[model samples]
Target: MIEEIRIENLGVIAGARVELGAGLTAITGETGAGKTMLLTGLGLLLGGRADAAVVRAGATSASAEGVFLVEPGSPAAERALEAGAELDDGALTALRTVAAAGRSRAFLGGRTVPQSVLAELAEHLVTVHGQADQVRLRSAARQRSALDAFAGPTHGRLLEDYRAAWTERQRLTVELAELVDSAQERVREAELLRLGLVEVERVDPQPGEDLELAQEAERLGHAEDLRQAAQVAHDALMGTDDAQAPPGAAALTDLARRTLEVVARHDEALGALAGRLADVGYVLDDLAADLARYADEVQADPGRLAAVQDRRAALGTLTRAHGGTVDDVLAWASTAGLRLVELEQGDDRTAELRARLEDLTGDLQALADQISSGRAEAAERLGAAVTQELAGLAMASATFSVRLTPTPELGPWGAEDVEMLLAAHAGAPVLPLGQGASGGELSRVMLAIEVALATAPSSARPPTFVFDEVDAGVGGRAAVEVGRRLAELARGGAQVLVVTHLAQVAAFADRHVVVAKTEGDVVTTTDVRVVAGPERVAELARMLSGQEDSATALQHAAELLERSAVGR
Candidate 1:
């Protein structure tokens, strides 16, 4: 519910504030006293289109601010919190500003927000019914929406089930058609994979075999050169053909060790040096044996070398076509094998999808039937409830009915077409609501429907309702009945604000606000003030007889107020 509204530089309302609460709050003023400006401010708060012309002259911009008491954990609070907005003391502040240059801005809970966010929040916060809304109610789509809202959860659940089945059937049909259309492409892909797999299997390359073969081929190609080098090294280390080779290195080291051992009794340092030479002689002997073994093993074999080179060339083909190495190529072959299976079974998969599509089609038809039945049942109860409400609104002989005509083709909603028709009086032929009801009757019918929807067990009633001049053509007892119903609707815990010129309707408000305008030489300003007690009675007197000081008008206004208070 809106706790307060502060508007500046909007229309004739230079600066004004309105305090609201749960129950009926009526806005009244002279026709040109800026009564509509109050509703305009509300419209701006709800993300309505911003008009530069509405900005007061000489003002840079016009702004409207509202403080709403949001229920904890409600959708309104959640949306505000999602936008990084803080809920202070369980109240959300929404503000909208329209500059004279046509720029518009919206703020929610102290955070700048898109105008659309305000609109999304408004869906759950308030429902505004004005003279224009009645025209909208005449539409077929609107009629369907009202009926569906009245139908409650049973119709809602059935509609959802039908839409789900319909969506799945559409998906399956599309997939099956795509598979059939791309049959040739699938076959081409399968054949490519088949040929690649065959070549990889035939060669059967080993992991890292290419690197091993390259090293072996290099060794075999230089076998003779390696043998010659090893023989020269062996001769130098052991004994050569020439005897004057200084007895090779090993004999010299052994002679040095014997010389040191003979002098060991004379010097201890000499004995240590002789021990190091003995160790060197053993290492030289081991090196000579290894060189001889290497020279014997190094033999050239052209046949084996050529076979290794040929196998390497074959493995290179697979690597270059598929990957950089043998292992990478093998990995590709493994994945391709799985894909080959899917491509080969394309026809089987297509058949499976077709069967699924057929099954979904049947399921969708059944669900559509259920939805149609639910709507049909709801249409009867909704018509009776609304007609009963209309009788109380001073249309005693009027009758309302909902007609559901089944169509051959199914739709997302159902196979039934919903239409609301009315009989204005006895012996009158039923006609569409737009053609049968006059402007005043239309107002009453819409009010009845709104009340019914608001009171529905399944409906999440909006916290506020703004009715702008909805009682345009209504007067006398009809106007009083409208007031009574508005008060009744408010008693159910909603903040109802009705903008009306009738004193009867205004008397029913728990709080009354009057917009008074004063025309100055260069500027006109309007202020909204809360009226009560004798002040409210005077305002109502002006509404009754265009004379606030008249004794008779005062008496009538007081009587109306007393009657409304007693009725409540």
Candidate 2:
């Protein structure tokens, strides 16, 4: 239940705070008095699209904030938790803001959140029965939902369980269907993959082989260049000037030996330097010998280079298509090979998969059958109850029913569609609600369902009922009946709000707000005041006779309030 709403710089509403209460509360005003602004503020708080135009002309931004007294396990609380926001059942506040740039922000229970979450939370908090809302009832989807809601708890749960099975089977069906959808394409892909695997297997490229081969080919391609470089280095280490000498007996070795001998006769620092030089000389002698052997091995080989080049080029082509590295290509081939084996098992695997599909389908069909049976039983009870409510709403001779029929195809919602059918008077066959009822008749029909569904003990989540102009085009006994029923719904602890011009409707409200507007160059602003005692009677008199000052109108307003109290 919304406990209060505060608005600042929102359209024509400069700054207003209205404290709402439990039970039926009505917001009434003269035309152009900005009562609709209250509803507009609600829409934004509930994640409606924001625009700079909604901001008051002289103001920089607009803000809407409200306090919602919540139940412990209400859908609104669950939505808040789902959004990574806390739900303080101790006190829950829903807030929204629109900046001059038209960007919007939302908050739930003091935690900043996304607009969608705020909207979802709002869904269970309030139901606005505005003019546009009437159009929404036209869709087949909405019709189906309303009928299901009317069908009550057992029917709803059965549908849920049935749809769960239906959903899982559908996922399997889609996966299996993908395999069937591309049979010809699969054959082509499988053939290509098989060819790739065969090629890689026959050639058998090894990982890291490319680097090793490139190094080898570089030497083989420029053998003379390598040999010259190695020979120059070996000669320099052994002494290059007309001396035939083993490297161990060459000049660098002799110089180090002589230096060490001199240092032995000198100080400690010279001896350490000489020892380091001697170690370097010994290392060079070993390296020269290795260089000579390496020189002997280096030689050009055109045929071997061509074979390596051709194989490397072939592997390169495979790398471009399959993977950049040999290991990656190999892994890809391995996976493709496994899948090919399965796809190649052909009809056997297909038949096995199809059999599982058939089993799931059979289970879903059985659940659907049970769901259909349960829905039929629930729908009858719901239809009769709604029919009885309609009788009080001035359609005494109306008939109502739910049409739940099965189809060949199953959807996320299950196999059958539920529709509402109604007849406004006797001797008329029941037709779809949108077709069989007039504008005013439709309003009453909706109210009847809302009032009925509000008190349904099995409703998983029931929104506060709102009846807008339900008393429109109806009066006398019919209008009084509407008031009585609304009062009853309020008595049931469902927060009920109505917007009506009739005193009958206004008298039913436990609390009433009257909206007054002033005219100026820009159409000044609106004032909303909660009325009671004499103030309420005056407002009701204005509503009843359009002239509150008249004596008869005041008496009539008093009688209406008195009778409503007695009726309660």
Candidate 3:
């Protein structure tokens, strides 16, 4: 339930706040007094499209904020919490702002969020029905929904079952079509996988083999130069054929160690130096032996060089076709083999899909029949209840009907189409709601339907309902009946807010709010305030007559209020 709404800089409403409660609350005012601004504020708070034109003149922005008291585990509360909104004390604050530059923002429970978040919450929070909704009721799909809503829990369960079966049938049918349609594509893909696998298996590349082979090829291709360089380095490190050359480092280190050993008797530091020189001599000898072995091992093998190069080329070809390296190509081949098996199983899959499709179609047909039967039963009850409501609305001779006609093709909803038909008077041909009824008559018909649906024994209805001028063109006792039925809906545990001009309708409000406009030399502003006691009567008087001071109008307003109270 919406506990309150605060609006700023929106239309002629500079700033106003209205505290709302459960039951029927009515907002009324003189023409041009900006009563509609209340509903407009609600629309903004519910994430309606924002327009700069809604901003007051000279104002930079317009904003509307609402506080809703939600059930503990309701969908609305869950969604707000999911958006990181803090639902403090079970109250969620929804806000929307529209800048004069056409920018818009939305907030949920003080957290800034996308406008769609507010919209999703609004689905379960409120249901707004205005004069335009009467036109929407003309649609066949809308008619179907209305009938189902009025049909109560039994119809709801049937629809749930039907939709589930229908969805499965659709899924199977689409899969079957796709599998049949793309047969050639699947075949081509399988053949490509086969060829790739054959090439990879034939080459049989090993991981890291490419790098090792490349290194081997480089060494073999320069075998002569490598052997000569190795021999020269070995001879230089050990000794040369020239005897005049300074003794090799090994011989020099040995002579230094021998000199240090002779001086060790004179100085301790010289003894330590003698030991280090002896270790160096040992290392030089080991290096000389390793160099000689390396020089002997270096040899040229053209046959092995050719074989390594050819193997590298084959591996390179595989790498180029599949991946950047031999390992990557092997990985692709492994995955491709799995995919090839799946593709080759298409024939088996087709049989399986055909079997599943047959089972789903049978299930869908049965569910559709059940849905049609439920709707047929509901149509009768709905038509009777609405007709009874129409009688109270002063349309005694008019007949309302719900027509269920079967279609050749079953749909997600059902196999039948629904039409809400009306006959305005005796001897009048029954026509669809869109074509048969006048605006005023349509208003009454829609009101009747709403009242009937509101009285249904279902807990799935929206918490708040805003009806903007739903009583349009209605007057006399019919207007009073409309108000009474609205109050009835409220008594059914839903909060109803009605925007009305009729005194008869306003009289039935559990709480009355009046939009009062003040005109200044430069600007006009509207204020919304709750009216009670004598103030409400005076406002109703003003609605009944042009002047609130008129005694006759005042008396009529008083009696109307009294009558409405007694009726309640």
lDDT of candidate 2 over 192-217, digit per residue (tens): 98888888888788887766777777
Ranking by lDDT: 1, 3, 2
User: How well is each residue in 1-568 modelled by candidate 1, as lDDT tens digits?
Assistant: 9999998888777888888888999999888777888888898998888999999888999999999999889999999999878898999999999999999999999999999989989998999999998889988788888888787877777777777888887788788889999999999999999999999999998888888998999989999999999988888777787967656777777888998999897888899999899999899899989999999999999998999889989999999999998989989999999999988888999989988887877887888877777778778888888888888888878898899988887766678778888898788889998798889888998898899888877877688999999898888998998999999999998899999999989999999989888765111323578899999999999999999999999999999999999988
Misplaced by over 4 Å in model 3 are: 1-3, 19-23, 65-117, 161-176, 240-249, 490-494, 521-527, 530-538, 551-568
Q: What is the lDDT of residue 189 in candidate 1?
A: 92
- Tell how far residue 44 is off in model 2, in angstroms: 3.4
Sequence-dependent TM-score of model 2: 0.84
For candidate 1, list the clashing residue pairs, or say none. none
TM-score of each: 0.75, 0.84, 0.87
Query: Which structure is stronger by lDDT: 2 or 3?
Result: 3
lDDT for every model?
0.88, 0.77, 0.87
| Candidate 3 clash pair list | none
- Native-to-model Cα distance after best TM-score fit, residue 238 in candidate 1, in Å: 7.2
